[model samples]
Target: MSCGMFDESRDVIEYHPIPLWITPFFFAGSYMKKRIGKTSIAEHKKTLLPSDEVPNYFSQNNLFARLTYLVFWYLYVMLETPRIILYSLKKKPDLFYGYEVYGARVASIAGRILRKPVVTRFQGTPLKINEQRNWNTLYPHGVLGLKSKADAVIMANDGTHGDAILERLGAPKEKIFFWHNGIDINFVINTQHGEELEKRYDLNKKTVLLSVSKLVLWKRVDRAVWALSALKTDYGVNNAFLFVVGDGTERAYIESLAVKYDVSDSIHFAGAVPHEKLWTYFTLADIFVILQDVGNLSNQVFEALSFGLPIVSLDDGSTTGILKNQYNALLIKKQNIETDVPRALAMLIKNKKMREGLASRAKETFASSVCTWEERMEREQKLLNTLINNEHKTSY
Candidate 1:
């Protein structure tokens, strides 16, 4: 049977998205001790909920994952589908909720069996109708037009992308809503330092630039190497060093790029740090930079803002203008990254006053515009309660 904490007081059962559980870019601990039963469940004023993870693939092992999926995922789903059904039968949850495709599909199957409402949070880009849905074989329901099975669908990150906006994902227009995940920063979460990291790196003396993300091909971290080189070659800012925080398939290429650009000495390759401890690097950074394929506004963006670091990122309208030039961040156009990244980094490094100004504004923007997890989840809870009530009336 599925594992979850039943809240009799609230009449709700939640499969809380285990903190970046599947995000290999963050930490392997998401799959390790960070999971529920392993860690002590702290009491919350609100009801405590149980969470679980169903990993799709390993980080930095995409191609290998695809090849092994035939052998692994089939057996994986085979075992899970039955447990999900049995869990639903045993728990008789008022409703079922899911995190991503795998969890969502399993929840859908359980809901169909129990005739309960299912709400799913789907963040990945939508697949075309004609495109083969590989996940079809993984679950019992085939998962074609899964949105139809879900009572409510939550699309991550503003949901304005072509697939989501055009309804190409086949989600009923009415069932859809948008909610970006919120950060948990009340008073600058990282007030401590990583001692070993401090001894190993010359972060205190050097002008530190930080970039945290999966070093995937699409993220284009190679361009950050180019900027790091520019800080030396073009701008002649020899004291500056770029600390890259992540590990992925592109790690080799990025390492090679650092050597190619002759800035190998100036870049620190701190492979994936534990999520809770990442704030150590954040507190140590002077500026945050990224050349993401999508617009800026990932978890790192908020973390940087909270840490009061000025941001230099590329925006492609994918996030619908979450960042503004010179107001909260320095936004680079996709077409101008070759010029924009170096220029932005150079400018921030040269002018401490402006850098501090932007950093201040970024912190202010986060305080004024952003919602914490408590606030966002409160809204989500209200929605779930409303949906349950509406379905109850409909049944009557």
Candidate 2:
């Protein structure tokens, strides 16, 4: 089953093509459906009512919101519950899949009731929410109830998230899987670099250190700038430049920090650019550095790897999975909230062997282990087939 809001993209595709780019890139995968479950009908039994949307504020703290979400989720499963009983129940699809944790948890119960499988994909900060937060006890400890019921879990980050699942959710070993979000490597690398970008930023033949992401608190982009500044002062890195990509709430603050540090000329904020044009930054950049503290994985890091650029990043949850100490990346740390990112970059520039070795290994990792659109489909199809076939054999 899928969440109803996911289909919201169809409305965008119909209304505005330009805005459709904002839709989640993976929504195209909705076409590949096995079977979804539904909740029980206490009312008309024969009719399954279509669900409605609830606002974000309602979901924030109200007890009714929690109960309604749980019940409607079960209702969703009731619409598809029969699919598990009969192997031929493929004429109509099952319940809708919800994208959030609350909806996914309720759907897990529906999966157990209907003997159908459920899988939840993680995209944001892994396991950080399991601690004693404002809404801590709404679900089970570490959200184990959902994990126990779910057939499998899909982690967008690396295997580092496996700990959060096991410790907080109490998920079994066999139930967890990893999917490194990747992009079109060759297509991105082959794109023509915009000459204007090079000339405007004075990045011609300069060893460019790139940071392409939203300007936000946890991203710690200031660390990258700090490193670049140090590289220039300590190592006489006159040939180096920093290309900052994307715009966000913290744009003004970041720019102000650049000026305060007296490295404004060395740093250039390119702002938000189209996806096609984003590749040019990679094409022109010599290295990429990301220091996200929350999410275990990022699209920017994948793009960097796809373009065969060496990465320098902090050892946070996002990079802890794929970024080994010295293999695929130059992993640094934040000492008392002050990162040694500059030291990491300085070492890389001094040792060309380490830089080339990291780029080579990252490319290999993307080709063999990272998941692409084709690979995701095949793996998902195989899992669904196995789940469906097992049900058939049990019935016989």
Candidate 3:
């Protein structure tokens, strides 16, 4: 939305998700059989969005939950697809841009029904999205069908990441675009929250280990908590403190793991930190950790890079070619993650010199390699404008 290339109210009709029901126990995603319609501008932008506030009530990896989710989603798409077609007919917008799996499917169906062009973006690695548990929105064959229908498909990568999934999906080579996710580098470099975080957490005296991600199985935040336990038990690193910086359906499971591992006292759940103030935790940490299962080099990883914290992550398919081990990050193999993650954390905790060295390398690498949000905005504007202006353009 910061890309403000087009006025949202007139030119675009994007999805703006909001809670259908909110309480201490049941959240928006948990309110099944609830879908409301609203149009409003996000606080940061003046763009009007067609809010399809739907219930995403299930986030569990179980046979019953999956079946229930399918039922709810089918009901939602069946009801919502007509409204989208009606809106498209009334507005007659030039393009239909659908985000992620479900949105893309809905848009593709509606676009086909109306004989309109559609553009869809793959938010994560599309092939094995099924393994993400409740985070999975579509099956491989379902996405394969969506890819074939879309006029253009956007993948969030700098072209260094492989395109085997696209090849497997049979997405048109000519219609593919590579636009990696970028960050506000200057904001992170310039912002400082001072000593309050340090004083509150006593970070100066502790080996502060930070993991910033939604508490999801795909994100593998539970691995970080287990590593914290291993540090104290196996390595005698009792002063280590782990700060987990996001919450989700997997939060209770992770909390249970912390208790099971006996690291609850040393673990601090910061929940969801506001974007503007998130720098405080970033700046107050000694080492950063994330074990993204599908090798998604996401925003939190970029934020960790900007903070110049030594990172501990997996050297997987996506990150292998991008993040070099030791020079920029300390990467471990996935086969032995339970053992390797904890051992890697222990190594970082014991060696302060190594931590400082890796931190310096990370900052230097980020300065040269990463693109800022402004640059991303420019690229997106150019591509989208071309897509809109030319009705006969072949490939970009």
Q: How close is candidate 2 to the true structure, as a TM-score?
A: 0.69
Clashing pairs in 1: none
lDDT of 3 by residue, 176-290 (tens): 7766687876554214453766667677789888888876555667678777887787788888988889988678877887898898988888898877667777877889887
For candidate 2, give the lDDT.
Answer: 0.56
lDDT preference between candidates 1 and 3, better one: 3
What CA root-mean-square deviation does each model show from the true structure? 10.9, 12.6, 9.8
Q: Model 1 segments beyond 4 Å from truth?
A: 1-87, 126-148, 158-166, 186-205, 392-396
Number of the top-ranking candidate, with lDDT as the measure: 3
lDDT of 1 by residue, 135-175 (tens): 44332232332443577777666322523532554666677
Q: lDDT of each prediction vs. the true structure?
A: 0.63, 0.56, 0.64
Winner on lDDT between 1 and 2 is: 1
For residue 156, model 3's alpha carbon misses the true position, in angstroms, by 2.7
Where in model 2 is the C-alpha error above 4 Å? 1-98, 124-126, 129-148, 158-163, 186-193, 316-321, 336-339, 392-396
Order of quality (lDDT):
3, 1, 2
* Candidate number of the best TM-score: 3
Q: Write the per-residue lDDT of candidate 2 for residues 27-129, one digit (tens) a residue.
A: 3222221111222122421221111111112222244434444454454345433432242233122322323454455445544544455555454323444
1 or 3, greater by TM-score = 3
